[model samples]
Target: MVSGIPWLTVLWATPTVGAALVILLPAAQRVLAKWFALAVSLAVLAITAVLAVGFDPGGEQFQFVESHRWIPSFGTGYILGVDGIALAIVVLTAVLVPLLIIAGWNDADGQTGLRGRSVQTYLALTLAVEGMVIMSLVSLDILLFYVFFEAMLIPMYFLIGGFGGANRSKAAVKFLLYNLFGGLIMLAAVVGLYVVTAGSDAFDAGTFDFRAIVAAVASGEFVVNPAVMHLLFLGFMFAFAVKAPLWPFHRWLPDAAVEATPASAVLMMAVMDKVGTFGMLRYCLQLFPDSSLYFQPLVVTLAVIGIVYGAILAIGQTDVMRLIAYTSISHFGFIILGIFVMTSQGQSGSTLYMVNHGLSTAALFLIAGFLVSRRGTRLINAYGGVQKVAPVMAGTFLVAGLATLSLPGLAPFISEFLVLIGTFTRFPVLAVFASTALVLSAIYILWMYQRMMTGPVTDGNDRIRDLLPRELVVVAPLIALLLVLGVYPKPALDVINPAVDHTLTTIDQPDPVPRLAEGPTP
Candidate 1:
C-alpha cells in the first residue's frame, strides 16, 4: 500500500526549500545560508528517521508512494515510491546530508579562490544535489528514474568544477564525459524498452512505468527476444558500472575524488556511487534477473579485480585524500561482489555496507579536510608528529581509520564479513582473492597511520591544534555510529533485511545460499 504520509514529497521539499532559502539569503548573511542548509538537512534527517520507523518491513511493496499524471499523452506519470532497497539508499542520503554540511562548515571558496559572493551558490547547489539524489532513490518509473539519475550530475559537476582543487574543471569534465557516454547508452536502452513494449502501434506508448514493464515482460505480454533483453541489460549495466565503476571503468573516481572539495568527495563516494550498486540491485537484478545471473562471473571478476587493484594502489599513495579515494574503490568492489554473489546474506550485506561505508568515508574525508585546512596540504609527508600536536584530530582519524579497516566492533566489519561469507558459498575462489584485500587494507591503513600520526613533532606541524568544538561535532555522531552499529546493528539491519528480502523476492531468488561453514582459505 502507498504510504499516506506523502513522505517522499516531504523528503524532496525539505531540501528544495532549503536550497531556495540558501539562494535567497542576503549577501551579508552568508553565515545564515550555511545554517539554513544545515537546518534543512536536519529536517530531512527527521523525516528519514520517521521513514525508518514507519516503514513496514513485511509489506512486500514500495511504500510512501506519491504519483501524479505529469504527461497524459505520453502515458507517463510522476511516480515515486520506495521499496526495501531504495529505502536504505534514501536513509543513507538523509544521514549524509547533515554530515556534509558539518564538513562544509565555514568552508568557502575563499581559500580555494571563491569570494564570499559564491558561498550561497555553493550551498544552494549542495541542497539541489540532495533533492536530486532523494528523487533518484524513490523514483519508481523508468523515465522519472532516468531524469533524476541524470539530473544529479549537474549540481555535482558544478560543485567539482567550480569549488574543487586546481584541476577541478578537468575532473568535472572527465566525470561528465564518462557518465554522459554511459547515460546515452542507457537512454537508448530506455527508448528500446519502450519500443519493445509498444507492440506494432509504432506510436509512443507514453508509459515508462517500472512495475508495468516488469509485469508485462514477466507475463510474456510484452515479449522482447532474450537476445534483445540481454542487450538492454548491458545498457543499464554500462551506466551503473561506470557509476559504481568496476575496474577499468573506475579511472574517473580517484581523480574526481581527489580534485573535488572534501565534502563533494564524501557525497560522491559515500552517497552517489552507491546509486550504481543500488541500480544493479533494484533495476538490473529485478528488471533482468536472467541477465544478472548469467553475467555474474564476469561482474564478480571485475569486482575482485577492483578489490585487489584499489587496495594495492591505496597502499602506494602518499596523498592522504587520494589514498582514501582508492580505499572507496576497494570498498565498492566488496559491495558489488556481494551483489552478484546472489545470496541473501550477500545482498543484505551489500546494502548494509552502503550505509556503513557512507558514514565511515564521510568521517574520514571531513577529518582529512580539517587537517588539510589547518596544514595547507594533504601530502602524507608534509608534517610529522600530528598526534603530538593534535591529539583530538589523531583520535578521530584513528576511529575513522579503524572503522575503514573493518575493525571487529565497527559497522564495516560485520558487513564485510557478511559479504565474504555470502560470496564464499557462491564463488569460493574469488572470495579467496577478495579476502586478501583485508590484509592489504591493514597495510595501507596502518602504514599511513604510522607515517602521519606516530612520528616526532616537526616545525611545520607546531601550529596544528586539536579538533575544535565544531570539528568534533562533525565527527562525534560518526564515532557513535561506529560503536552503536558495531555492538548492535539490529536497528538498521531490521529495516535493511526486509528491504533486501523484497528485492531478492522481486528478482525471484531464494534466501541465503548454503555452504560449508569453513571460511575461504587465503
Candidate 2:
C-alpha cells in the first residue's frame, strides 16, 4: 500500500477538484455550467466507488490514510482517513450529490437574478460542502477536523440564503447563528484539551490530533483534572447535540427544511445533520469515554423523547416536506439511542443507518421536489390519485416511503433492527419505547403516500405525467441500493464490523454482552 497518500484523500479531493473545473466555465453558459457540474459530480462518484470497492473489511485501523505534519510546532498535521464508519458516510455523500444536482436542474429558487447562473454557484458550493464534510469525517487530527467541520457552514449559509424559498433569509440566519454558537463552544473545549495535554513531547506544544488525544486519555498518561475533563466533554457534547439537534436544539431544522430549496434540504438533512452524530461518534466517545458512560442515561432519555415527539409531529403535518423533515428528527433519535448504548452492534448499526438514511432521504426529497415542481404545492391534501397519471413517480414514492418506515427486507429494516436489538441489551425500556416508533413511522409514511398517490384523480393532476427519463436517472440508483443492501447487507456489515470492534476496544469499556431474553446475569 502507498505509505502516505490515503485513498480517502482522493475521495475528499474529487469533489473539490471537480468544483474547480466547473467554476472555470463562462458564467453565462448555463447549459455548459449544468453539464460541467454534472460531469464533475460524476467523476467524484467514480472515485468514491473505487474507494468503496477497494476498502478492506478485515483491517481494524483507518484505510487509505494520508498523514503529514502541517504545523510542526503546534503538532497539527494534515491527516485524513476513513474506517468503515467514515467510509459509509463518505460514499453516501457521493451517492447523493449528483442526484441533488439533477433535482435542482429546474431551479426552484423562486425569484432568480442570474437566471441559471445560480446553478454554477449551487454546484460549486455543494462540491465544496461535500469535500469539507468528508474531510471532517476522515481527519484524524483534531484541529484539522475542526477546520473542515466549520468550513462547511460557509457554503451551506450562502446556499440557504441565496437559493432558498420565501423567508429563506431568516431561516439562513437562524441556521448560521445556531451552528456558530455551538462551534464556538466546541473551540473552547479543544483549547481545554490542548491545555490538558501541553508538555507531552508526543505532541510538541500539544497536538490537536484526535488519535493522540484518545491515546493520551485512554492510557491515563495525559492527565486532565477529572472535573476539567467533564467540563470539556460537556462543551463537545453541546456542539454535537446541537448538530445531532437532539430535541430542544431541533427547532432550527423544521424552519430550515421548509424554507430551503429541496436540494439544499437534502444536503442539510442527509449530509450535514450526520455531522452531529458523527461528532458524537468520532470526538465525544473517543475523547471522553468516562463522560460518555456518565451521560448515557440522560442521552438515551432525550433520544427516546425525540423519537416519540418527532414522530407525533410528523403524522400531524399537512406539508409533505415538513413531514419528511420531522421523520428525520425521529430517525436522529434512533441513531442517538444506538450511540449511547455502547454496544458494538448499536454503534455499527448507527453507522450503517447514517449511510442508508442519506440515500433514502435524498430520494424522498428529490422526488418530493419533482411532484412540487409539477403541481406547485407540497400539501398532502392538494394531491390525490396521482398514480393513475404518474405510475412510475408513485412507485418511486412508495419505495422511498417503505424504505423510510424500515419495512422488512429493505435497507433501513436491517439497520433499524440492529439498533433496537443492540440498544435493548442495555436499556430495554428505552428500546421498547423507541421500537414503537417503527409503527409510528409506518403511520406517517403510508398516510402521506396514500394521500398523494391514492384516491380519485384531481382535475389539475389528471394530466400530470410519470417520472421523466431524467428523473428516473436521478432516482434509480437510490431505489436499487435500498434493495441491494436490504437483500445482502453482508458487504456493508463487513466494512463496519472491524472498525466498530476497534472503537469499542479503544474506549476500554466492557464488551456489550447482549442478553437475548430477560434472565439472571450470566
Candidate 3:
C-alpha cells in the first residue's frame, strides 16, 4: 500500500543527504550539527516505524518496492524493497544510529579519537554509514547493492582511522584491506552473474536485476555448469565470509574494534557487518541454492570452529575492548551457523540474533567506553571493584554481558535457543559441539565481570563515576529492548516466519520432521 511513496529512497537518502548537509555546517556550529544529525536519524527512524506498522507480513514478500529506470541498457535499474528479513534489519539500522549519535556526542571533542576536527565529521560519517547500510539492505538490484555495499567502507574507514585509538591508522588499514579483497572477489561474482544470464535463454541481454535472477535460479531456467556455479558461489561467499569475518578472516576485527572509538566500533560490529550475513541469506542461498547445499557442510564446520575459537580466545583476552570484539566473532559464528544450517528456525533465529546482538553489544561497548574514558585505560587488570563506585554502570554492564552469553531472560537467549534447536533437528552432532560456546561464553563474560566489576577497589577504579545522565539515555533503551524482545519474540517471529517460509520455499528446504517412536503393540 505504501508502494507509490518512494519510502525506501527517502529512508536511505535522508541520512545520505543529511550527511552532506551536516558537512556544510560551519565549524562554529558543532552543537547545531549534532542536533541536526540526530534529528535526521530520528526522522529516518520515524519512517521505518511507519513502514513497520504499515507492513503486512501476510502480504507481498517484498514490500514498498520502488523501481525506476537507471542505466536500463546495462540491465540495471534503481530498485529497492524489503522482505521481512530486510525490514527487520533496516529498522535495526534506523534504531541504532540515533542512539549511537547520543552516545558519541562527545567523542570528537574528547582527548580520545582523532585530533583536529569538529564533531561534524564524526557525526556525518556515522550518518553516512547508516544511510549506505540501509541502501544495501533494501536494494533489489544486485549492482546497486554492490555499489553502496562498497561505498560504506569509505565513511567507515575515516571513522576508524581518524577517530580511534593510537593504533587507529594501522587498524583501519587492516580493516580496509581485508574488506577490499573481499569486495574484489564479490565484484567478479557479480560480473559472472550478468554473463551467465546474458548467455542464457532466460534473458534478452545481461541483467543485474536480483529478482529476475532469483526467479530464473529457482525455476531451473538459469542452468549453468556445476563448476562455474560453484566458482561463482564461492566468489560471493568469500566476500561475505570475510565481511562476516568468520574464523580465519577475523584477525582484522579485534584490533579494529579495540582501536576505533567505542561508538564507531558498535556501528561496525552491530550494524555494518550484518550486511555480509544478510547477503549470505538473500543472495548466496537463494541465488545459488544448489551450490549453497554443496558447500553447506564446509561452511557449517567453519562456523562451528569460529564459535569455539572465538570463545576460547575471548576467555584469554587481556584487553576489555578486545574481549568484547572477540565475543562478537563468537556471536557471528552462531549467526553464520544458523544461516548455513538451512532450516527455518536456524535462519529465522539467525536474523533475530543480528538485531539482538546490536542492542546488547551497543550497551556493553558504550558502557565500557564510558568507563574507559573515565579511567583512561582499556586493560582488564587496570580495573577492579568498579561496581563499588559506579553501581548503575556496573549493573548495566552485567546485564549486557549476560545478554551476550545468551542468558535465559535476555534477547540473545531466544535466538541462540532457536538456532541450536533448528540445527539439532538436522545436524545434532554439530549442534552439540556448537553448544559448547554457551559454557565458554559464560566463562568469559562472568569472569570478565568478576575481575573487573566485583573485586575490591583498586588501580584508582574507585574514582570511576556512575553513568551520567547522557550515558543513561544511551543504555536505558537498549536494556529495555533486550528485556522486551526476550520475553515476546513472537512479534518479531510473526513478521520473520513468513519470510523464512518463503525463502525455504524458494530454496526448497522444508524443516525436518521428528519421527515419533512407535507405540508398543497392544
Model 3 poorest 10 in a row by lDDT: 109-118
- Each model's lDDT: 0.85, 0.85, 0.93
lDDT by residue (180-245, candidate 2, tens digit) is 898999999988887777855445567787877788778877665668878888998888888778
lDDT of 1: 0.85
lDDT by residue (67-147, candidate 1, tens digit) is 899877666789988877778878889888888887887656464354455788888988898998888888888888888
Error of 3 at 388 (Å): 1.1
Q: Please report the candidate that would top lDDT against the real structure.
A: 3
Strongest candidate by TM-score: 3
RMSD to the native, candidate 3? 1.5
All predictions: root-mean-square deviation over Cα?
3.4, 2.4, 1.5
Candidate 3 lDDT tens digits, 1-522: 445788889989999999999988887788899999999999999999999998899998998889899998889999898999999899889999999999999888854333334588889999999999999999999999999989999999999998889999999999999999999999999999899999999888999999999899889888899999999999999999998879888989999999999999999999999999999999999989999999999999999999999999999999999999999999999999999999999999999999999999999999999999999989998888999999999999999999999999899999999999999988899999999999999999999999999878996886788999999999999999999999998988888889989999999989998978999899
Clash total of candidate 2: 1
Residue 192, candidate 3: alpha-carbon lDDT: 95
| Superior candidate under lDDT, 1 versus 3 | 3
Error at 23, model 3, angstroms: 0.5
